[model samples]
Target chain A: MTTGSGGRTVPRERERPGLTPEESALVVRIGVFVKMRWLAIAGVLIASLIATQAFHIQFSLVPIYIICAVMTVYNFLFLYQARHLNVEASDSLPETLAVPLRHLLIIPRATSPLLARARATGNVHIIVDLAALTVLLHYTGGIENPFIFYFVFHVILAGILLHYRVAYLVATWAILTVLLLIGLEYYEVIPHVHLEGFAAAGLYQQGSYILSVLLALSTCLYASAYMVTSISGELRKRQREVVALQQKGLTEKTRELEEASEELTTLEEGRQHLLRFLAIASHDLKAPLSAVQSYIQLMLGGFSGELTDKQRQMLERSSIRITEQLELISDLLDISRIEGGQIVKEMEEMSLSQVVGDSVENVRAMATDKSIKLGTRMPASLPKLKASGVRLKQAITNLLVNAIKFTPENGEVLLRITEQSGDIYTEVLDTGVGIGAEDLPKIFDDFYRGSDREKAGSGLGLSIVKRVVEAHGGKIWAESPNPEDKKGRGSKFTFLLPKNLVIAGKKQGRKARLKSQET
Target chain B: MAYKILLVDDDPDIRDVVTMLLESKGYETVTACDGIECLAALRAEEPDLMIIDLLMPKMDGFAVLKELEDGRWSKYRNIPILILSSVREEASRRRYELETALEFNVDDYVEKPINPEVLLERVERLVNKNKKA
Candidate 1:
């Protein structure tokens, strides 16, 4: 049920979920048709009034007014019908509902019946409007009226809204209707109700005028239809390509995200494996090592027998060295656990002030032994953060011990805790031999000791501190020749922790930690 | 007579050193190399207290604790158990805490790379507690 790369299967559902682009475009064009009809209705109404009332041109206004009323009525009907179709086309129905309509209205493939009906209605509108315009022109000198050229506008509308063949058919229909009107009037088959002052007298009867005018009108209508249809066809093609390209980009991004997630899963498994190895290795190595150290203690305690001072001193020294190695193994395990993201399981709401206080008290003896002055600068009240108190104490203790180890006798070490914005800042500043510039960047690396390797430590102390801080979603950095120190010889190590530390993969870590504990 | 302590570990070096340390302190120690031997020694020697290691060759400490809870060893149920672990003390303590919460009995834990004084002090305390109870 899953891919090899863990990528999700492509979705089968439609993205738009509404009408196909062809159906929607037809709905919009129907709206535009109604608007253009309204403009024509107004022009007819105003032109009739201006010709008879203002210019006193002798033409009966009753028929022209009646035609305007008819145009208004049909325009309203078209507007209402277009609104109903618009709602039907744009509604996003459930798949079950749409499936029933698939053959009838919801086909995303070739033109469905709904779109065909819309195109049919478009053709009918153009035919009816051309007929009305011819009737209106008949009363106003028929072929002599220049408004007869208005048929070309209908041809243009057809080109944009209908198929190429339909647009040409519409143009032909306009030409045939106009020719019928002009021929009927010229041959005296129908009476030409001429506008008395609008054109030269008897211009409607001129054979040369009719021929040249009809020639120009036919050429103009066909030209407009051809040009408009070709341009609109190219535009629709480009629109589809853009949609396809966008879909491709989305799929690529989804694949990339899935790959990254799988990589993280593999890395997590590797870390759990390493944690297991470390646990077993620690026990196997430290068990015998500790047993050896204990035997030395037994000899030193006179349990075996009373020992010479030389043997006692040597045993004590060896005991100290084994203890250091034990501590080093512990430090290594700590780093492993931190990197494995097990710290989240140990986290609880606790105050940083308490951890800082305990760490300071823990290192007080070491400081006193070195004759190093210890100082603290922190407010009485501090914010609580979600952190592993034991790990934090370990980190703070490492910092304090590192500071004291490098600081000479009578030197000063300061523990400063400050709250800034939403973060808590803890700085350990010591008046000791400052770190070299060459070693500053690598100080946080495991087993990286500075030029001051003469000082005793596992070299993993600062790295442990770094791991602990980062695991809690915090940052730690070191500054050599502490800028704020007047002595200008000490190093400053500061770590900033947010009031709320958010561990990544916290939920997953909890599950794994519990499982490891159960084992 | 001095109190008897049962020491269970798979490692020979740990058993020898710990037994020597306990004997030096005037406490007699019975040793078992694994959990099977630990149960056998508990029944045979009836030591005053048990110091068991967690990781072993057969039937680890947790399974042994579960076995003790099965009522077959109900007569020795009052015997205190001290867990000696080389795994992190927190992890071992948490495991034993869960076992005890389920009513499986264990008394104390000592992490290895052990400090001799601390181990002896804990062993003495558990043995005395067993006597008092």
Candidate 2:
């Protein structure tokens, strides 16, 4: 009972069934043939007794009784054979346990009835059919007899059980045998046994009559044989299809399994590449910038040669500008990394107050420098959210920074937290430069700086916020000059997140995986 | 007496700037362009303090820590180490923890684009601590 990879329980392999559908089909054919034989035996006995006693038909009773006894014995022999086989797969040994040797030795030397492992041969029963038909034909009427149709019945059964050519040949032989019997009776070489109560001896003796009758009988036999052969052919084709379906099922499952394992290997390589790229970007991109900034700081701090006020002012300007550019580059990297699937939500039962509190406080100093009132409006007790604190903090901080950047001095920037039915809506409303109608749609797009507002940013901040909100099964939008907003020059950025999260992860990705598995 | 501090960096501009920055504060300074040169200089004449950059050619800052793990610090002057690099402080700390199994740690961590006052204060405090010990 070893566990499979990924902790899946391994299914134990079971032994194949004693009889597959085809084999069971063969058993059914044999059982049906035996049943028909029983019907024939009863029919022959009743018909012979009625013909001999009531109708006084001119057939010998002793020969008919002997044939019946032979058929009965054959039926008993086949029935005895059926007793030994355990076709239901009941007697097979269990995989977990062993059968004792003494049990095998104690069994009688009789063959197991249902133990018929060999593929069923339908042609094996052909002999019994032919013998019975020949005996009935000989006893009741040889020529000028309706009992002659028994030959056609036997030939049709042959067509169903045997190959087309063999069945056709059997039908042809039966027709020729009838013609020979009729010719002999017509020429006075053998006796004609006509059906009792129907005196048709004159018809059998007429050359023209026998010729037409034989011709029509031959055609009928051929057509019946062809019909049975075609039906049998259709059945065999369907059986072959069943086998092919099983094979196709296995192939499809194998292909799906191959694809899944291949995906994991690819994921492993992707992780390694991502880590290496991050390391290189950290050292190569930031290293030189840091070095230049360090040098500029030293000069400004009087570690280098003494600088005049003008020189100091220019150097400090360069330092601040460089710091801002470095910040933009870092934000660009964050945006790219987050898009490349670095946003993993570590779910915790944290409040909306907690999610938004620290970020507003962090941006307070910048807001105060402009004399802007930065405030958060929330319910007395807000609902908790299941999300990653770090990513959520980053998103809130970006929005606040944008609000502070756009808002003029003394402009009020409000962070409104409200529950809209089931959704938790967080809006950052700023009163400053309102975005134009044309620029509203493109505001959240990456690297899109509104042609109206002059504030420079990587322009990825709002897009990242949108992505984070959507990843949490929520959405974000921005509305400038909103009707209910107090500030005329207002740009309100609102994002709604469900307070009750439906599992914190990529729902789309997992759904795609399950959909693939189903196929 | 001026305390001697070893400044190791791959960037020559940074090495010179840090060297002069320490020297201007009355500490004697020697600069090595990379970790290889840094180790060689350490073997030649030990310093009171070492300021190592995390990323360097031939041998990195982590490699220096691994090399010094073999009782080499006991043979020389007790050199309090400080890591100053462009790598995030948390990333560097995690690497050092993994490499030295937290048994050893840098005396101070100062990220790049450092404030001159903070750098000098951290350096002087480490040097003073080493002297007292």
Candidate 3:
């Protein structure tokens, strides 16, 4: 022991708070056994002294002295082992003690062969050792021995540390020892004392019975305490697990909320940008419209006579150019609205042929003006696809308009609808200015037009078509089929849609028979 | 005698097209490439009507309109001003409603690529309207 700055003397064993619970508990139990057995050693010494005075039992004092000497030596040996055991047990404990306890118990069984043998023997070998020790003690003194009840203490200790079967074995050994003493007294195997006075009457019989009852009662108490402690320890472990699971769930929910907030901020920024562009575009458009209005005012006022036919014709062309600019601005605004995720799709089953024919009719005047031959090839039995009719028409009309715009006079633009494997494949093939291979991939991106076709477009038509196709769970791609043959190398745009529309409340079978017939 | 007209715009191609159309119609037309030249031509020879592009370098169409309003010359003052641009309708409506303290007035607005028929019809109507007013 050494005194620390705290002024309290610290034992070498207690200096390290690192003991495993099982190792520490075993050391505590062994210490208690040593203390309890001291009283038994004293009782044996007193009994020998009483025998020498009352009966004048004269024999070689060597056996008596030898028994006392052996008891003294065993007590000192136990004390020495207890101190070392305390130090070893304390050196292993820490804040995280459970793993160390398991390691301490399990490692000794593997590293030390003797300890492994002892553990493998389980409780059966312990009971045999206790039986041998009790039989040796009985030979030293018959039933007249006062220290015989100490065997009960051994039984209770064995019951707490070892299995219940070992406790039962030890109890059987104690009962057998009493029976053997009774048998030896009847046979006159040593001097047997018979008590006669009231003080001595019933003393041997009552003492034996009381000691047996006490042993059984203490065993039961120890077992109940062990059971309660184990159950409470298990409940605490389960509670820690539940808390960890709840914390993980809360962390996941917090991450999802953070992602949603980031997306909302991005959308707000996009809205502000669009508003700024709209302001600038509105201001720039006014200049040209004002010019046309001013010129008409002067011509009509007749400040300089009536205009000739040539002057009238010149003014008509200027008005046409302004109208085209207004149309381009309106289309740009529509595309912005659709991309902002404000547009909702209303999908229905409709005939592909009719939609194509109607789109051609809408743009027939532009085709005639450009002298582009616009025609469609529809299979007699065409597949009806689930789609938003308005969006589908818009997409097709954009493709047709581009084909007519880029194709030279008398070039052919063909629209074909083909059915294959529960899908409708629509292809728009045109004899026009084919897109370069490099520009093919970026054609479907917003505001992306081929450099070759830069002057002719607002660059939004193909992007809108791609958006509509993707919304319907369809795919669209473009290809230049005849790159080597420049005259026949016009671009082909094709898209695929599933024949059956699987949406809410709609049956799986053909839902629009009347619409297909109209085509 | 055909009236002389001055056409001013920033785009060379648009200026060429308008010049061709106006000359083909037998009107004697003088062209200025931008607002600065349009203002210079206005001082040099006052035309019947001034057609100006809204967006340009050095000076813009609105600035030119402001200059016309500030000038005291009766030939340039009270001349009908038309804004030809590619801006949207909402802003065009707003520009028409804008009132300066000096009482500057713009006749009307038109968008591009200048529908020839509508351009002639609107110009003829505004000229007739100014005469009646």
Candidate 4:
């Protein structure tokens, strides 16, 4: 699989899965070890030459020069081998693939059985580096040489890259090696290589100087290792906490999405159940109401037999009541049909003035019965509107009939239609016992009747009108104390329909225009 | 000429009431329980007008219209069809027109709980209009 700059590419399963943690870490260690070896080779070569040729201060130069040359060549070879193993690490089964024998053939000095043991304890390579360093320090005056600073570098490297215990072991080992070197040179166990061509300083002969140099070198190495390990430990703990917080945030978002969809599904099911209940109940009521009215009308028409005036009067009243009940049921059905969101109304271009005139005529008799004045206020040349004419007429008729029911004798009811910014506004205003502030809020609600309502009737009319107005893509509302009234009297109901409702699904040159002559 | 009406509805009460109402106006009515029976009755006695209901068993009003359009009963093509039911007329009418690739092929729409005066006026007008045409 190809890894991008983003890292950790999604692998092609059939091609191969990615590497495991153990293999990846081991390969990275091999790469870092190769890099460290190159640094060591360069540092040794530079230090050796500065003392031998530049400073002319070296006693034994041939053996150190040969070791430096061999180290440079060996480090270059190890770099090539490291890259080869890394490629193998990526291509192999990614876990438990044994390190090749060549991996053990490290260090320019000698091949020891410690190759496998070095990888096991993981700090054995650092031990080998320390061995090489001990030899360099031996020729350079052991503890007296400023080159002893190299021990401090190895200690810091171990602290950052290896376990703390391993780093402490390596630091302690460096400190012990210095003391042993000073002891050997001072006791003449190994002959001291004092500067011959260079000026000989008694700094090496003074036992106090040797003792103090050893003390400072050992302290510096152990102190640096301790500080680096503690700092790195704190950084790692913070990184783990950040990762856990990100995972928690992801899980919370997923749960919220699940809950939102569940709520939507439950809401949809509840609406459907309610619509079914309304339709079945309405149809059942309609059937019997139809039968009762039919039988009653037939008897009143003298089909069964002649009736006395008293019996006829009673039958007529019952028939009228049944008719009113049937009308209420019809209005309730209309509201549910629209509220159920199951209806598709057929809209057409029709005259607003004509509709208003026709609806007002239907209510003229009611107004006459109450001696209430009914009228219209509209332009004679008004623009025609595109809407379902039958439903709009029903809305107007309901408003007018409501106004007449609440109005006292000789009160005024008016129908007005006008054009505003981009909508057609139809308003119905009535002057009578004005609506109380307490009743205004629930006036349009279904089955609602104000305590001050002049008469009792099915409260479904205004609710049906509200649904019809909304279904036509319009806004409807009512206000008390008609804005035109000076005395804060009368109620005004108005609704506005937009000039252009999208022609429902215009396909293949189709415009929904019911022919005017269909009437 | 006397104009006869064929009253088709699954509801027996609606059928009986409509027949009585129409007969009271001195027009004869032949009754049927469903669309299939209505089509058969139309063959036995060719009515001047047909009052059809949309929802019924054994066949519905639209199926009857389809069979009539297909000319299985070709002779009754000129008879006027009046839709008399509680179903929302405009929605069904548009559906029928779209499905048949024809315009709403009926004379008038009368929603049930109907105003009887309006039904009678439309019936008389349709019969007279057909005669004049």
TM-score of each model, paired residue for residue: 0.64, 0.66, 0.41, 0.62
lDDT of each residue in A203-320, candidate 2, tens digit only: 7677787777777778888888888778876875687689789879999999999999999889968966886687688678887888899999998998878999999999998998
User: Ranking under lDDT, best-scoring first?
Assistant: 1, 4, 2, 3
Scored by TM-score, the top model is: 2
lDDT of 3 by residue, A330-376 (tens): 56765764555433434556656667778889789988887888888
TM-score of 3: 0.41
Model 3, chain B only, scores a TM-score of 0.80
Instruction: Give the least accurate 10-residue stretch of model 2 chain A, judged by summed lDDT.
Output: A1-10
The alpha-carbon deviation from the true structure for residue A198 of candidate 2, after best TM-score superposition, in angstroms, is: 9.3
Winner of 2 and 3 under TM-score: 2
Candidate 3 lDDT score relative to the true structure: 0.59
- Candidate 2's C-alpha runs over 4 A off are A1-31, A52-120, A135-146, A175-220, A230-279, A304-306, A344-352, A380-384, A436-439, A451-456, A481-489, A499-519, B1-111, B118-133
Order by TM-score, highest first: 2, 1, 4, 3
Put down candidate 3 lDDT per residue, B53-115, tens digits, no spaces.
Answer: 776778877677767755365567655666666653334443434534443356777666555
- Candidate 4, which CAPRI tier? acceptable
Model 1: what TM-score? 0.64
lDDT of each: 0.78, 0.70, 0.59, 0.71
